[model samples]
Target chain A: MDLFAERGYAEVTVAEIAERAGLTKRTFFNHFTDKREVLFAGAKDFEDSVAKHLAEADDDLEPIEAALLALTEAGLALAQYGDYARARQELIASSTELRERNLIKMASLAVSIAEALVRRGVPPGRASLTAQAAVAVFTDAYAAWTERGATADFWNLMQQSLADLRRAVDAAPSRPSGA
Target chain B: MDLFAERGYAEVTVAEIAERAGLTKRTFFNHFTDKREVLFAGAKDFEDSVAKHLAEADDDLEPIEAALLALTEAGLALAQYGDYARARQELIASSTELRERNLIKMASLAVSIAEALVRRGVPPGRASLTAQAAVAVFTDAYAAWTERGATADFWNLMQQSLADLRRAVDAAPSRPSGA
Candidate 1:
């Protein structure tokens, strides 16, 4: 994270990242395909954890509720990496490629959440919307937490963001034409 | 679209795309930077149209309502190209690069919507959430519309999707644990 921050992500080579970690280049290659992969290494784990939580959620929970429970769990899990996440956010903001990768990762997580909802017996359309809405709430909470720094509790942010999403949706206006 | 659908986005060349359009390679270059850019040529226009509609929405409308209006307009505009959209969707579904581009485009539109909301005097956090929720509705509606083809009215799908989102949010349960 320091290497990417001090030097631009584009300017930082794999050798340098490996050197900074006191690992041999060959060892680094064994772990990650590229320097960019290092920053995103936790993405799959995060997605899986959220999916697992959703899958294990109570049967009585609504699909969105189950997804939110997963999100809260994911937020708590990510709290330990607040500094790293914020640093990575700076790098992602600076690089279009990294931003695309991050968005794609989030999009993939939404699909996973939707699939999990389907497994929980949600109809496809409802599953999809609930998943997308859940992901949206998670993204906003994560962003707010990162922006506010480590002092903020991610779980609180996640909960509050979900509540805010509910209020926003509830307050939504009917179509202008009233059709 | 045919070239991409048949041969894959990675395999298709700009020359082939140009030839398919009955135009010279030079003419294609004059219009688009590359084959990928051709697929996303309308993205900016879509963003602008949505932002414009949102900005022009009635002052009495809620932020989410304003966003829905813009989405309604955008959906109506996109409905005219259902065949082209679905074909492009298939090509995008098959390719990581195209999918990333599509997600990035949607993400960019989200930012544009939030900015428009802010310009209309909404607070930043509210603007961001409203924008994301609106996009979630649009995405679900678009997917349903594409699947149902021309048989479904885009407006109705969008309305139904927003209603579904509201219900999903309203049904969201509180965090599972006190933590």
Candidate 2:
């Protein structure tokens, strides 16, 4: 990441990265397909953990609660990644292509979660909606935790985000009364 | 979109589109920057319309409400696109590069909405959160509306989505006591 931050993602060469870490190019390839994978390396593991939680959840739990349980549990673990997480975030934020890729990754995750919900007998539309909304709350809360230096538990921060959204909606200025 | 979808986004060459439509490639260039733009022709216009709405919204409205108002208005206007919308969506769905571009376009729009909130004195972090949450809600609701043969009002569907999220979060399964 230091190498990336210093040299920019586009300018940094794979060979340079390999040599900088005292590794052969073959060794680097054994670990990652490309530089982008360095920042996204954990996404697959994260997704699997979330999926496992979702699968193990009580079948009767509300879809949102079940998904939130999975996400909060997953987020709690991810929160431990700490500065490494933020640096990855910084790298993503610095590049347009990465930013786009990041959103697609999130979109793809939401789809996977939604598919899991659907397979669990959740209604198709509701599953989709809950999946997207869950991702939204999780991402927002995760950003909060990262930017604020981990002052709060991940689940608690998620609660605050849900709380904030409620406040925003309820406090919405009155629409036309007679419309 | 019909021409592109009938073929594939990449397979349908620009010259073929112009020739089949009895126009010169020059005319196509005059409109779209490239093939993908044909799929996203309305997105820029939609964003501009939303920006206009935000600019006109009551200055005292909360950022979330202001964003909803703008997006709701745009969504209604977008409902007019109909089957062209379906074909365009299918084309983008079929192409990874196009999908990434679309997500970036959506992210750019969210940033624009966030900027409007920032200008209205919303805290930068809060503005970003609100904007992201709003986009999530909007995207979900739009998906709901478009999944079937939707021909009615758009704002109403948005209102339904807002209600759904509020209910889901507020009714979230309570945490186990003393956990």
Query: TM-scores across all candidates?
Result: 0.88, 0.79
lDDT of 1: 0.82
**Global lDDT of each candidate:** 0.82, 0.76
lDDT of 1 by residue, B31-146 (tens): 98756678888899989999888878899888888888887886678767879988877787888878888888888998999999999898888888888888888887787778
Leading candidate by lDDT: 1
Please give the distance, in angstroms, between residue A32's alpha carbon in candidate 2 and its true position after superposition: 6.3
User: For residues A26-69, could you state the per-residue lDDT of candidate 1 as single tens digits?
Assistant: 99999987656787898999999989988898899878878888
Across A5-70, the per-residue lDDT of candidate 2 in tens digits comes to 898888888888899999988899999976666678778888888888898888878887788778
The best candidate by TM-score is 1
Residue A139, candidate 2: Cα error in Å is 1.2
Q: Which stretches of candidate 1 lie over 4 Å from their true place?
A: A13-35, A172-179, B14-35, B172-178
Error of 1 at B43 (Å): 0.7
Stretches off by above 4 angstroms in model 2 are: A13-35, A58-61, A119-121, A150-152, A171-179, B10-38, B59-63, B121-126, B144-150, B176-179
Q: Cα miss at B162, model 2 (Å)?
A: 2.1
Task: Please tell me how candidate 2 rates in CAPRI terms.
Answer: acceptable
